[model samples]
Target: MHAGPRPSILFVTDLAYPARGRRYCDEDIFLTSRLREEFDVALCHPRDAAALLDGFDAVVVRNSGPVLHYQEAYDAFCARARERKVPVYNPLTGRGDMAGKQYLVDLSAAKYPVIATVDRAGDLGLLPGAAEYVIKPKLGADSVGLRFVTPDALAAEVGAEPDGSVLVQPRIDFRYEVSFFFIDRDFQYALYAPHPEQRWVLEPYEPTTADLAFARRFVEWNDLAHGIQRVDACRTADGDLLLVELEDLNPYLSLDRVTDEVREAFVARMKTSVRALLH
Candidate 1:
């Protein structure tokens, strides 16, 4: 147990958020219940976080849902957090999905094992030839504004984004999707979906050394000194892992799917991370 006065944490979440295939409220409720044992925990919606932050020792963002739904408010919260120098879990400096989808393009350019991404028409050639290509907003989440276009329609689709606000990638033919969860750079657990079309029917995954190495590459590249991160990837037909995304900001913890022992360990690690952040 912590010896000093318990540090107060403003746990930010949207309890009413109706996420498909997951209960945001249940996850946040369970997490906060455990966290309350070690800190002064209070729940607030993301829109209210900036207003409520001044009174807390730190802010813990969990299952707040996609910031796109409340972009203006979320941006304000970020600005306020920066102005106050408030320590936000998953720190705002994260270069992964927290910032935007641009990291996909950056990683692909660096020859990382990520799906090829391009925003401009000229660079579209870099992507492997596929019958259909994916087009998604750079700021999109939860599959928002995602569509598949044929090669004939690609240029028009690319040209339609006058502001260059979208990214394009080849729709990868993959065997399955998997996610690796981490707390403060330590691998906690892994989960995977056996069916490519059914993403949320997750089962506990025991990652091989090669799988761990692949996932760790992005975690290490993200370089977040503290906080939780989820490395999402897909296994190709050729048996290689390709990064799908690195979710650092409010990544949903599918806590319901893991074993009780794994959940306990994750909660313990999170408490340790929060304590480390406070001191």
Candidate 2:
């Protein structure tokens, strides 16, 4: 190995943002601690990233909370990074939730195994019928502005939504929600919420080949050359997985719930991935 000063990384995060179930600060703290072994790392709030990221070899945006919280600042950071050609860990080319929820509607229309979505209120008939439907802002994240409406009220509620501002889908009665975590194109570990009612109580998941295939389909579809991605899906009563969301930017890694062996492996893979980016 060539000897040189370790690469400096500007780690972007919002440590104080109160996430409902996950500890954004704890995950980022642990990750940075591990990363520090291989690189010179520093933390900065999302709003500060544009100004602070200039001198770093790369920037890793982790648990930075929803960009909507600081849309203008986040946009500026992305623009500046592009102009300066500074490497972003999860490169700015992500087209999944990193962009917005519009991908759900596109994926659904493409006949993918995704929650059926329609952007216009008049298109509710396009989706499979259900007792209730989900209405949420297209730019929303972390369950922000998410709500359920019965079919009777869905039309009116959606009709009230500004054009192209929200998406509507049937409220899936799912078995469990699971997530497949990845670094670049590599699969890391998986986690799932056993109780639908408690979204935060996650357990280690051992994915089957079929499950991996399903998750991989979306990851491959996203086609990012670098960066972390979390493919979130809901297993239905019929045991089929439907895409819930694809979180490519700042997907939380539940490091504590994973075995120490797994956690270390992830860190190692991440270091390899980041190193690959720097190279």
Candidate 3:
């Protein structure tokens, strides 16, 4: 073992969270085990993160489940980290899903290659002509409260909710979904579910230069200096990629699906990133 002061990290996770199609605990367990080689690590539930972060050099949020489940606690932790100036992995500056789904509406307004999104009834005409629309809470995660409604029923469904509390989008019939994983702005790996019905049955994806360029656009837009990010998108029937979500907050790495060599490389990159944050 190397003799020196290993920085301490309070790794936040929900080891018991019942994430569908994924094992949150096993990924965190594997990550923490590898991280232990370079830092003094402690595991804590998201609820305990705010209270337990004082003594650690940094707080790393991983697989903590959706913040919607514990919004108050997660907000408190974020506020505390900011108030006390404690470094947080993902850096608390992400404008992606970490903030909310508002980015979708904003991106759509700017004509970015994202699924057509609108939160207001008047803007409903902006979306492409589709048989059904997908509506979900602006603060939702893990597909919570997601519903599909026909165009005729769209206004009632959207108007029933508190103004600006939900987002509506035309449900595109995409060919497949793909995700690009990045570490500190550098593309690391990509995975895709060939079958649209089975979103989690991922296979290693060899991204074309054009594909990488498409994914990188958002990464460049986010402008995050460090932290892990997952660019989730769907390939439309017309062979265009549109942003589905930008998961900057504790995106499940799906390490189990990748090769051992790729996993090792990811861990090494993470260790270096953490060290850079400390310095």
lDDT of 1 at 71: 94
lDDT of each: 0.93, 0.92, 0.93
Candidate 3: worst-modelled 10 consecutive residues by lDDT: 1-10
For model 1 the local lDDT of residue 51 reads 94
Instruction: Please give the lDDT score at residue 235 for candidate 1.
Output: 94
* Candidate 2 per-residue lDDT over residues 1-279, each given as its tens digit: 224588899999988989997788999999999999999999999999999887888999999999999999999999999998999989999999989989999999899999999999777789998988999999999888999989899888988875879999999999999999999889999999999999879999999999999999999999999889999999998999999999998998888889999999999999999999988
Q: TM-score of model 2 relative to the true fold?
A: 0.97
lDDT score at residue 279, model 3, on the 0-100 scale: 79
* Per-prediction CA RMSD (Å): 1.9, 2.0, 2.0
The worst-scoring run of ten residues by lDDT in candidate 1 lies at 1-10
lDDT of 3 at 25: 100
Compose the digit string of candidate 3's lDDT tens values, residues 186-269: 999999999999999999999999999989999988888889999999999999999999999999999999999999999999
Q: What TM-score do all the candidates reach, one by one? A: 0.98, 0.97, 0.97
* Clash counts for all predictions: 0, 0, 0
- Rank by lDDT, highest first: 1, 3, 2
